[model samples]
Target: MRGRQLRRAEICLLVTVAAVPVAACGSERETVERPTVPRGMDRQADSDADRLAAEKAALDAYAGYLAASRAASGRSDPHAPELSRFLADPLLTRVQMSILQAKEHGAMRTGTLKSDPTVTSVSLDSKPATVEIQDCLDATGYRLVYAKDRRVVPGSGGGRHLATATATRYPDGRWLISSGAAHQDQPC
Candidate 1:
C-alpha cells in the first residue's frame, strides 16, 4: 500500500508539471505587426531628390535666359555677355541673331520685361535631362522704341505674353536653355 501511494504521488507530480506548461500555452493573446521596408528604397528616395534639384536648376537657367534677354533689349548693341551664361547651342545663336537684328534696326527697349516662370514638367532619366517651364511675361509697362526717332515700334506695346522653354542639363550639371518660344499679347 505504501509503494502504491508513492507511485500515485509521482504520477501526480509529472501530471502537474505537464499541465502547467499546457495551461500557460493555451492563453490567447493579441499579436502586433510592424511595417516592413523593401531594400533600396532609401537609395531611390535620394535619387528622386537629386532629380528634383536638377529640374530646379534647369528652370532657373531658363529664367536667367529671360533676364538676359531683357537686359540685352535695353542695350544699344543688344549683346549682353551674361546672356550666354544661361543659353546653349542653337538657342544661343538664335538669341544672338535677334539681338543683332534689334541693333541693326536701331531699336532699344525702354522698360523691363518681367517674367514669372513655373515648371511644367521634368524628365530625369534621359541622357540629357529635360525640363519644361511656362512663363507669364508682364510687359505692360515695357516698350521697344526707335533709337533715332524715339517712336514706339509696332507690336512693342507689352501687356502680357505666354512663353515656354525647354532646358537641358549638361554633363557638368549646369542647366542651359535649349529651346524656347514666346507668344505676345497672350494670356498665361
Candidate 2:
C-alpha cells in the first residue's frame, strides 16, 4: 500500500531519469472576483446570502483542486489524498493518470504555480448547483524535472495560460471540481 509516493527530495546522482510534462501541473491560484450572478442563474430565486455562500464554496473547491493537483504532481503520486477530496471522476481520473505517467518516467513537477482565477458564472437553480471558473495560470515558476538530480527538464518550463473548471455541488452538500482544462497553447 505504501509503494508509490514519489519523494520531492533531490535524488542521488547515479539514478537514471527522465522528465515529466509541465502541462500536468498547476497551483497557487487566487480568486480575482466574487462570482457574478449571470444568465442561467436566478438572482430572485435564491437569496443573496445563499448565492454568495454557494459561490464561495465553489471557489474553495477550485482552490482545493489546484493545491491537490500541485502536491500530487510534485510527488508524482496519482493517489494523493486531497485529489479525491476536491475532485470527481473524469477530471479526477485524468489528473491521477498524468501523475502516474510522470512517476513511470522517473519525473515530477515541482515549484509554485501562480494564477489568477475568477468565477465566471454560477447556476444554483440547476438540479445540482455548479460554478464555472476561468483562470490565467502563470506557471512560469512551475517546472517539470527529473526526480533524480532535481534538474529541470528541457522544454518543460511553463507560461501563463488560460484554464477553466466546473465546480459541482453534490447531493451530499460537497462542492467538487468536476472537470477542468488548461489551454497550454493559449497564453493568457
Candidate 3:
C-alpha cells in the first residue's frame, strides 16, 4: 500500500508541472498594440463637421426663401398693395416719406407709373438680403428694379441699384422685407 501511494503522488506532481508550462506559453505571446489619436485631434474633427453642417443648412434655407419669393412675384404683382403690406416698419415708412419729399423737391416726378420687377436671384446673409433684379424700368420718376428693398436714394444707382433689405416673418406665416437702407456702408 505504501508503494502505491508514493506512485500516485508522483503522478499528480508530473501533471501539475505539465499544465504550468501550457499556461505560461500562452501568456508569453505578444499582443498587438491598438492605434490611438490624441483627444484634441478628435475634438477638432467633430467641431469642423458641425460647422460645415450649419453652413450648408443656412445656405439651403436662403435658396428656398429666394425661390419662393421669385415664384410669388411671377404669380402676382411686385408692387401690389399686399406686397407693400409686408414692408411695414419704421425704416420702410421713412423711406416712403423720403421719396415723397424728394419728389416734392423736384428730384423726381410727381406722377408715378406702375412697375412689376422680376427677381432673378436672391442671397441672404445674417444682416442683409442681396437680390438680383431684372425687367426694371423708371416709373413715376422711381427706378423699378430688383433691389434689396424698394425706395432708392439718389446717387446710389448701380448694380441693379443694390439696396440693403431686412426680412421679417409675419404671424400669418408670410415673409417680407421689414426694413432696408440704400447701401451697407451708408444709410439711405
Q: Which candidate should be chosen as best, given lDDT against the real structure?
A: 2
Clashing pairs in 1: none
State residue 117's C-alpha deviation in candidate 1, in Å.
0.9
Output the worst ten-in-a-row residue range by lDDT, candidate 2.
22-31
lDDT tens digits by residue: candidate 1, 1-188: 99999999999999999768645754433122323447798679888898789777987897788778777877854457888899987788888888788778888777777888888988888888888889898888788899888799997677887988889988887899989888864786
Highest TM-score against the true fold, candidate: 2
For model 2, give the RMSD to the true fold: 27.2
Across 97-163, the per-residue lDDT of candidate 2 in tens digits comes to 9999888988999999987889899898898899999999999999999999999988888999999
The true-structure Cα RMSD of candidate 1 reads: 12.6
Collision pairs in model 2: none
Q: Which ranges in model 1 have alpha carbons more than 4 Å from their true place? A: 1-38
Error of 3 at 82 (Å): 17
User: lDDT scores for all predictions?
Assistant: 0.81, 0.85, 0.44
Off by over 4 Å in 3: 1-35, 77-188
Quote model 1's TM-score: 0.73
Ranking by lDDT: 2, 1, 3
